[model samples]
Target: MATNLDLQEQEQIDAVKAFWGQYGNLITWTVTLVLVAFAGWNGWNWWQRDQAAKASVMFDEMDQAVQAADADKAGRVFKDLKDRFGRTVYAQQAGLLAAKVQTDKGQADAAIASLTWVADEASDEDYRSLAHLRLAGLLLDKQDYDGALKQLDAVKSSEFAGLADDRRGDVLAAQGKPAEAVAAWKKGWDALSDKLDYRRIVEAKLTAAGAQPAASGAAQ
Candidate 1:
């Protein structure tokens, strides 16, 4: 019986070895590919973290320059951040801040240039929408009605739908299109929540444009 058992075990070992011999290379290669892919994913994550860390430090420097009211220094740092990490949220935020500083210093053209860059190049949709809104407002202040309307039209976020509509209404009103202004304000009002105090402002705009507000219950 022991001899029989020994022979059976030997046969089983041989069967396993034969199976492995037929498929060992494929299994090894499959495992190697999986491991390499996992390692590459980890490496990419590490690289992104390192890049974000460096970009964050530069953003803080830009903020400090802004707080100090040093426009030249802020502009220099912001330009560096944008050139090096334009895809970073911090870089986009710095651009907005720098544009505000430039505007406050009577640099409307420079402010528009900065805002235009962010509006066109920001990786974040929300940031791009914000840049377009601000840029449109600046252009409207300069009475560039067509340019303002174009900028407002470029805003892409549904969340900014109300603001964009309201801004568009303002532009249309300025251009003596009261009927279009009222229609835009109505759309904006309908998008806003009933509880929002801002809705009242839109209602007032519609009223001023010789348009009647929808019934209070109709503002869905």
Candidate 2:
């Protein structure tokens, strides 16, 4: 009986060896590939974290420059942030800060340039929209009616639709197109929710534009 048990154990060992001989290389290669992929993924995550950490430090410097009311220093720091870390939110925020300082310094053209860059190149859609809106306002202040309208027209957020239309109306009014302004304001009014207090301001604008509001059933 001991001899028979020894023979069976030997046969089991032989079967396992035969299976390994047929598939061992394939299994080893598959495991190697999976491990390499996992290592690469981990390496990429570490690289991204390192990059963001460095970018954030630079952004802090830019913020300090702005807070100190040093327009030139802020501008230089922001330019570096833009060049090095344009994909970072910090870079986009630096642009806004730089633009504000430039505007306060009466550097309208520089402010517009900074804002235009953010509007065109920000990775975040909301940041891009904000840049466009602010730039449009600046252009309107400069009486660049067509340019302002173009900027306002580029806004794509549904939540911004009413405000963009309202700004468009303001620009049109500035250009002596009161009829078109009224029409734009009406569209903005229609797009706004009834519960929004801002809609009353739109109503006032329409009234001032000599466009009578539609009669409310309650008023009737």
Provide the overall lDDT of each model, using Cα atoms, as 2-decimal numbers: 0.87, 0.87
Model 1 C-alpha lDDT per residue in residues 1-220, reported as the tens digit of each score: 9999999999999999999999999999999999999999999888878878999999889888778876777678778988988877888998899888888877788788888888988899998999999898999999999999999989999888888999999999899988888888888888887778888888888877678676763555
- Where model 2 places Cα greater than 4 Å from the true spot, the runs are 1-37, 190-203, 212-220
**Pairs with backbone N, CA or C atoms under 3 Å apart (clashes), candidate 2:** none
List candidate 1 segments past 4 Å from native: 1-22, 142-144, 193-204, 212-220
Clashes of 2: 0
Writing each residue's lDDT as its tens digit, candidate 2 over 159-216 gives 7788788888999999999999999888888877777788888889998878857846
Worst 10 residues of 1 by lDDT: 211-220
Each model's TM-score?
A: 0.77, 0.74
